[model samples]
Target chain A: MTSGIRPKRDEETVIAGSCDSENPRRVDGLQLLGEYRGAAYEEPRFLVYRPDGQAVLLTPLLYRVLTHLDGRHSLASVAERVSADHDRAIGPDGVRYLVEQKLEPLGLAVLGAPVEQVPTADPLLSLSARGVLFPARMVRTIARLFAPLHLPAVVAATLGTLLALDLWMFTSGQADAAIRTTVGDPAAMLVGVGLLLVSTLFHECGHAAGCHYGGARPGAIGVGLYVVFPVFYTNVTDAYRLNRAGRLRTDLGGIYFNAVFIVVLGCAYLTSGYAPLLAAAVLVHGQIIQQLMPTLRMDGYYIVADLVGVPNLFGLIGPIVAGLARRGRRGGRHAWRAEINLRPFARRVVIAWVLLVIPFLAGGLAVMLLRAPTYIGIAWRSTAERWTAVEQAFTHGQVATILIDTFATLMLWLPWVGLGFLLARVLQRAVRAGIRAVNRRR
Target chain B: MVEDMTVLEREHVEFLPSREALGGLVNVNIVVPVNLAIAVLGSAALACQNAVGIIR
Candidate 1:
């Protein structure tokens, strides 16, 4: 249904000049969802929703043209309508081009019969999450239960708890002793690891709750192998529809949950003097810090991206680096412009982040590479010894020893499994590249 | 379709130069750097403790 707003007849005549007789083209199942002014761009952007669960941003002019595509008007007439409404000269050719190139890609319109699919390869192989474990309904329920924790009173409590915990750690040597004992005691270390995993799950829940609080629907929670590490991930992509604060809350929600967990642990330690809980709190702190490392797409990187109002900032690294190289080669006098979809300030921030990240990542990778052999050797020896122990226990019919040894053996081999996955991924990419090259030649 | 239109009408539209954007800049410039510093100092302290056999 049209909004019932129409332009003046004289304005329509000027816009429809000599091209309003073509076949009317209509947008199939396209819906104008909403509009938002982006921090990165000057123009107000409209979200056009397709029936296929996908949404794309369009400029106001394009949106105006789209609104007129009710199958009752031809492309020329649509152009005329938009031009009349906006008091500008938008020709039929411009309308045709926009419909064919822009709208067609988004599956927003039927330009004719469907085009043949081209087999194109993506240069990057993204590790996608396996499946949704916690569905949207379950997530929403959980999010509601924890929504009150985001209140001002809870915020004050969190701050108080942090200060108290810091004071405790500063005054007493118990934290250090607890950490040392936890590290040396295998049983304690295992329990601590379990606690950390639970905390990580809660961290993801925190993200979901924040999205819910921000009026965005939280999707599924799933696990994926990010690089070599199997990590938990939550689908908060609907947070994209939200403004900057909403998205930032979702990004920082995990760490906020970590803080809440620490507060509970700190209170427990104060009351019971159980140092291992404090030690677990320390480990959670380490995890939080690790997540803050912006080299990888973790909380810290998302925070940066959200702050600059850019999505998929990592994907822009290639073009930004290339733009820098091009600038250097041109003697750095003229301004180098790369076709990056970012505001000027955002572009600068991204360039700075890339420069900082590249060195940090390279240094970290170099260290890991240098220590790989020693690490692998240690793991192999440990796993072999554990396996032998397990075998001996099995023969002796020592059930407890067998179980313990089996667990130990599996723990030792986990790194090897991760390495194998990494190698397989690399080999798969190489094979795909070779096949593509051969096909290109053919 | 009527329900969808109602939802769209209720959507909150904020213009650019949003408070969220400014807050994000502060977070990246100030908060992240402070966190990074804390991590570096903590690592150094841990390394020192390890060297002195305090952690062993």
Candidate 2:
């Protein structure tokens, strides 16, 4: 190997495929790291340096192989195992080639016959690793059910009207008294509760339909937590491939649909003065308020993401915050300058003073923690009460209201947690894939 | 575990030379799930406020 080579003065001597010989030895199994051309490896990549000082960028596949190559496998045995796992045969030539190309460079294998170095691949994206809440089957099914629909403009119009009515209800506060009434008729209260749930479904449908109209394929929809916050999400990663206008359509689509539903619900409420209609109107209007909150991750965040062309705006926020923190730790004036570069805003402010990072992270953690017990309690209470109500079938069917409300709550909260994980995973995968594809071409 | 990779001949380094069509890298993030979960939870929480007579 090019030995006796003098190092250049200025450049950081990049000794390609040479091991550090003078360093102290590590444990028997743990060896060196390898380095490759930085351009070849992407971000979210890890580098391992052998105790000898040579660095290697572990590919996802190579990383996995290495993990399984305990002392239990001989050189040929390891080769056979890898070949079997990868659905290929690793003959002597293949094994030797791998040793020379990958394993040798990382200082894990020898060049000639009986090479021993084993390369590993990066970790697989596991659901359990990321704390997936529901079973994969359940997640898939719900997501399919919530999949974006290609509806007629008439349906879109109906949603838009509903959203408008919601705005009216909130702005007018006409539904407030009816919703707040305590001594209401039990039947009326039950109907109101049902209408409220129907409105939420309309809101979700709006998101799916908007995605369709925007010419993006909508994947599964489900619920999960964002940090600690319980949420329901729709998969619109397909929209990322669309142009700016298409993305905007998809982003604002949910609210538009919500508005249309509101108008219809509001008109009905006004005409009949029914308490249930008023409750439904209130429910629809609440979406507008929740969605518009910029501090929260909602439709508005997506709007901002689309507006800024940063489809993963929320994801970027964490990195930006981390970068700032690192700078601050290193006494960087830029980091301390408190110049926050959010997707839609660029400003200088006291991020720490604003407690943006702390509260945000804490809130997220809180949501995640609350998800389990709350869901459990809701399930337990709802089922027990519903069953009890059913048992007294002839006496009073009043228990139906309790059961209905309980199921509605579960349907709502369960999805928030389940879909959060799903959307994050699916869209993140699509974005990563898109990036890799672009990089490969370039 | 170290090997002198740079010393290998062209034939020995076949693993690095073979070209295969790469599929696009999908960065499967959990953002959608988180956002949707939050919205659902938030809306549900709000819905519960009415159901339990918390707001009333």
Candidate 3:
């Protein structure tokens, strides 16, 4: 046999050969996070944490081979060790096959190299804002301080407060008045908007706190544009190392924090009889409801994903749809099956989620597109009026008016900017499709 | 004689990966139909409101 690794035709088996002694296959810095027993799946799985905050699940057999890759052992030696330990004849070829097919794809195994450079522009990185704010260490410190609030008693108290606020709103008849007053007064609207912004920041902190509580390291907390709307996101990807319950807690933590903020606002409304505070509380409730929408990559989507033990439910949608189309064309009676990394039950749940989400998303997008021009025009006019007011306030040396006008301008221009972004995205997709068609013809 | 032979056969059996059957009944069968019902009812209600001029 030649003393070099060669790719085999069969996916399950590789051609057994002597590996190079000088350049041994090694697992660089892959952290093995023990085993995870998912409720949906029969087999126990383990997680491999990558340097770039991505986690990959592996079967026990693959994990055993991973433990043997310590930079010193050749592929042959590693296979021998696994065979000795497990009493199964997993030859060097099998080891190489697993490493190349599984581990290498996840960036866990390094073959014939000590270090691999991180990609400068990962597709996921584009979804997030540039640069990190609140590094891991800082997040950990803040999380430690808020750890006490995550206790059972504190959680119960927060839930009680929410119930009380709901009861009060039902009885007092002030809810409608608060909404009307806030809508009528620009100043009140601005105050409510400001409160909403602050509450969103608090919501992100809650996610970080939940991650810490679950014994996972929360990375940066930053602001970025999700589609057109600016949103706060905490890097709680490490929560995948946690069990399903812990992951769910992390997903729901943001909404929990929003509830806490609402309670505080409710108390303020009760004390000062401030209509704007109550209005802001109502707005926060609306925000929580919106976040619970599972159609998008929001908290509810993550919650469902964790519940079903599927990491990338959205990614599976395209394949599932394509498979369905193919099956229909072939006149198959049964639903088309694809190799999505999900259990039977979880797969069913994902299909249901996709079916519900598709129509809702399509309808929402259709409505938005139909009304875009009118909405855009209104936003433009409002922003111009606000800007003119701002200039007048500035010329008159009225600092307070200028601040209010600036806030108003921001509020007005945001919708316009969002519509523009949506238009641009649609056009880009259309252009790409046209280019593909042209290439096909050529 | 038969028991002794069965035991020997069991000892030499090879372990194979489990191939669980993908059952016919899925959660989507129930959920998708129910969601469709809701959508139909909701659109009907909206149409009624619009006809009555209660909604613009």
Candidate 4:
């Protein structure tokens, strides 16, 4: 049945003595079904009829909003009522807008004033929330640049050369002066920091471009924190929706981009002998170390996930932990149980997770425990440092100076243990899943 | 005939096996096409690393 639009009428569609001015209304009428303690009406009582014959089964409070909207009470009064009732500082315009947006489409709500975008509902993952957060805008920008690169062997060879050369320099002790010099110069430091930021942006673009190549739309990119470490994330969630081949492209996108960028950076280093290139090289080297760290939620971890055909290794950890918990509860019940109930592949995988997690978790805990005081002290000092920087900037009118310095500091420390843990958990699951596949085959 | 066709269609769409489904009924967990791409990448990364002399 097609519901056509109905004309608006300017009258208070009042419920007969059902509404109380003292009390509030809920939007959902079914919730208020029991609240009408003394109200009486025919079947389907307390319905405030809209102009289009679409009746809103209002709770007493909602009906008040409708009753007050007589084109006489200003929208402000309505907003205040809603705010008082809902505990949200919903503006008069917001309430009307929300009601209007819902009603106009259904031909139930009539316009009293213009509608605007409502206040954002508080999100679970705040901009501050730690872990794998990607902003959509940055991801889109990245995708545009990422789409042109081909999977040329030369690109890989070039990247390989850069990494080897950097490692060679560090091992040979020839790069120490270069590193020290780059760190000492503020102008050099800024360039190094800028290049690192650009590389990260390129990394996310890799993921987006990979998704595009794989027939998926790359979504939003944003800043997210992995525990205390802040990261830039692009929403390539659509990549997961694609086939395993497509998913791999998305996973490798960042590294592929990194490889190409390093070649360019390396060439610049070779040509100019600039101290900034050395700094950039060091920063790029650090990024490579991070992405290759298979134990964390880095690019390497996602590559493993895609290889293992796991949609979300991180999400699977909770269920795996729960299963372990249940096993612990069973305790000795299975002491003499059939040892070979699971397929060989599944058993091998279970063993792998246990083997991987036990030492990793223990080692991680030990490291945390050992460094806890120092880390805490550093964090406190860092916080103090940030505030100091901000205050000094403000007092001296050098906000840009402080901000640039702060961003540089974040790049240095962002890919530490926090990201390691995230990636570790992901890798553990991927490895276990792979083992499970092998066992199933047997 | 129509009922038989509907039953086949339902089975085709129902990809995953139930926890209660027998092991023999389980199809081989074939590595999807994308997984192959990732393997290629992993090898590529390793190959790139080798070429660059990260590993001798």
- The residue-by-residue lDDT of candidate 1 on A1-442, one tens digit each, is 1111122233211211112334434444555766643446434567654443334556676677677776677766777787787744677777666655545433455454432231111213223324566787898898888867777688688978887886777578777887877655444554565667778878888888888888877777766544433467777766667788888888888888888988888778779877678888887777778678666667887788888876556556676777777775654423344245456788788889989977775565455456667656665665565566556656767554445446445444443454456557667777966987999999
| Model 2 alpha-carbon drift over 4 Å, by segment | A1-174, A180-183, A222-232, A294-297, A328-358, A363-395, A408-442, B1-56
For lDDT, candidate 1 versus 2, the one ahead is 1
Off by over 4 Å in 4: A1-144, A153-174, A318-347, A354-374, A381-442, B1-56
Candidate 4 residue A406 Cα shift, in angstroms, is 3.8
Clash counts for all predictions: 1, 97, 0, 27
Q: Under CAPRI classification, how is model 4 graded?
A: incorrect
Residue A328 of model 2 has an lDDT of: 43
Q: State, as a TM-score between 0 and 1, how close model 4 is to the true structure.
A: 0.48
Model 3: CA > 4 A from native: A1-25, A36-39, A42-45, A84-89, A113-133, A183-185, A328-338, A362-374, A395-401, A411-442, B1-56
Estimate TM-scores for all models.
0.72, 0.45, 0.73, 0.48
Which candidate number maximizes DockQ?
Answer: 2
Ranking by DockQ: 2, 1, 3, 4
What TM value does model 2 have? 0.45
Tens digits of per-residue lDDT, candidate 4, A1-442, equal: 0111122233332211222332222222211112211112111113332221222333333444555454444557766765565433556655455444443233233453321221111111112333433454655665665675744565557667867876766786646766667555444655666777788777777778878777766876556554324566666654534666776777777777777776677667778888777666665655755675444455665666555543333433434444555575555325312221223443345446545655654575566556656644554455455555556556766544455446533432443444455456556656866987999999
Consecutive 10-residue window with the lowest summed lDDT within model 1 chain A: A1-10
Better of 2 and 4 by DockQ: 2
Per-candidate chain B TM: 0.37, 0.35, 0.38, 0.33
Q: For residues A166-227, what per-residue lDDT tens digits would candidate 2 score against the true structure? A: 57766887777767551144456556655655555455555655666665455544444443
> Residue B47 deviation, candidate 2, in Å?
14
Residue A17, candidate 4: alpha-carbon lDDT? 23
